[model samples]
Target: MKPTTSEMEILQVLWEKKSCSVREVHESLNKKDVGYTTTLKLMQIMLEKGLVVRDSSSRSHIYTANITEEQTQTSFLDKMIDTVYHGSTSRLVMQALGHSNTSKEELAAIREYLETLEKS
Candidate 1:
């Protein structure tokens, strides 16, 4: 399932923390000053969306990402490339590079990856 932007934020917290309560999730995003109730509500919605699993056995429920980070990234990237890039990965790459200020080090890493791909 594709998570919304807000849902993705919550998933990121869960992915990083492994398992945490709503309060923990809220604290993680406290820099953004997001409300506790808002985070709670989003977590509930995420449970319904099958994006997270809640352990309600204890007083404070624990939440964990139902999907792996790589799985979600791959899904999002595949959909984006298919729709926005019209199924052309090279076009997507060019467009991304054209828009972003990629550092030389990052570009070198990308070049290395491309070389590996060519070798394969």
Candidate 2:
């Protein structure tokens, strides 16, 4: 299932922490000004949706992402490329590069990746 924006925020914390209690996620999301109960409720919903797995053995329930970061990125990117870019990866790349100030190092890394793809 595709996660909502709120769920993605929680997933970001989980991805960094590997596993976290609701309190940990709530604290990490403090900048967003989300309430603790809201965070807890969202995590509970995520668990039901199979986006996260919970360890209930302990006093505090610890949650971990059921999906890997790479998998989520690939899924979202594929959907975006197909729908938003009309299946044109070049269009997506061009639009992204045009709008953003990409660093020289980043551009070089992208070029290297392209070269590797070409060789393969």
Candidate 3:
């Protein structure tokens, strides 16, 4: 599913908070200066996009992510590396490593990720 920028923002919030009501989503979004109705409307549209689903049986409609975070990340990163990194994941990794200070734990996690990749 191709999410517009607004949809992506809403998805990011939903991913962080897990299940949430429209009011809760609105409040969290308003903290970022987005209007409440706008957030509500975007979430409604996101449902159409198949990125979110809402249950109305609850006190407030509890919204849940219909797409997994891994799926979203993989899709976005494929686009990102193709566009931003000019199709070079090696360049992306080199730049990320060179430009950012990765913590020891983060480095260990990266190593573990690479180890799993090698096994596959």
Candidate 4:
């Protein structure tokens, strides 16, 4: 399942830490300007949403991602491609290539990518 924006914020920290209690998650988020209770409720809601799994063996529930980082990114990219890029990966690639300060090596890599696509 995909997390909402707020929950995704918490999930990012959880992914980085591997596992963390609510307080640790809250403290990590506090560094990014989010409130403690807000992070708590967000994670609590995420637990209900099955975006995270909480270990209840301790007095404080320790949370871990039910979804891996790759799955999360793939989901996000799918949505963004469908919505923002009109389901066109080429459009996304073109936009990125045009927008960024890509080096010659990066351009050569992209050319190689296109050649591989053609060969396939």
The C-alpha lDDT values of all candidates are: 0.93, 0.95, 0.86, 0.87
Mind giving the per-residue lDDT tens digits that candidate 2 earns over 38-59? Answer: 9999999999999999999999
Give the clashing pairs for model 1: none
Per-prediction TM-score, please? Answer: 0.90, 0.94, 0.79, 0.83
lDDT of 4 at 1: 71
Using TM-score as the measure, what is the rank order of every candidate, best first?
2, 1, 4, 3
* Ten residues in sequence with the least summed lDDT for candidate 2: 28-37
lDDT pick, better of 2 and 3: 2
Error of 1 at 57 (Å): 2.4
What residue runs in model 3 are displaced by over 4 Å at the alpha carbon? none
Candidate 1 Cα outliers beyond 4 Å, as residue runs: 31-34
Clashes of each: 0, 0, 0, 0
Compared with the true structure, what per-residue lDDT tens digits does model 3 show for residues 1-120? 778877776777889999898888777776666777888888888888789998999677899989988998899899999999999999999999899999999999999999999999
Task: Return the TM-score for candidate 3, rounded to 2 decimals.
Answer: 0.79
Best by lDDT: 2
lDDT of 4: 0.87
Q: What is the C-alpha lDDT profile of model 4 across 1-120, one tens digit per residue?
A: 777777787889989999999999888777566667777888888888888999999899899988888999999999999999999998998898889999999899989988998999
Name the best candidate (by TM-score).
2
| Alpha carbon deviation, residue 73, candidate 2 (Å) | 0.7
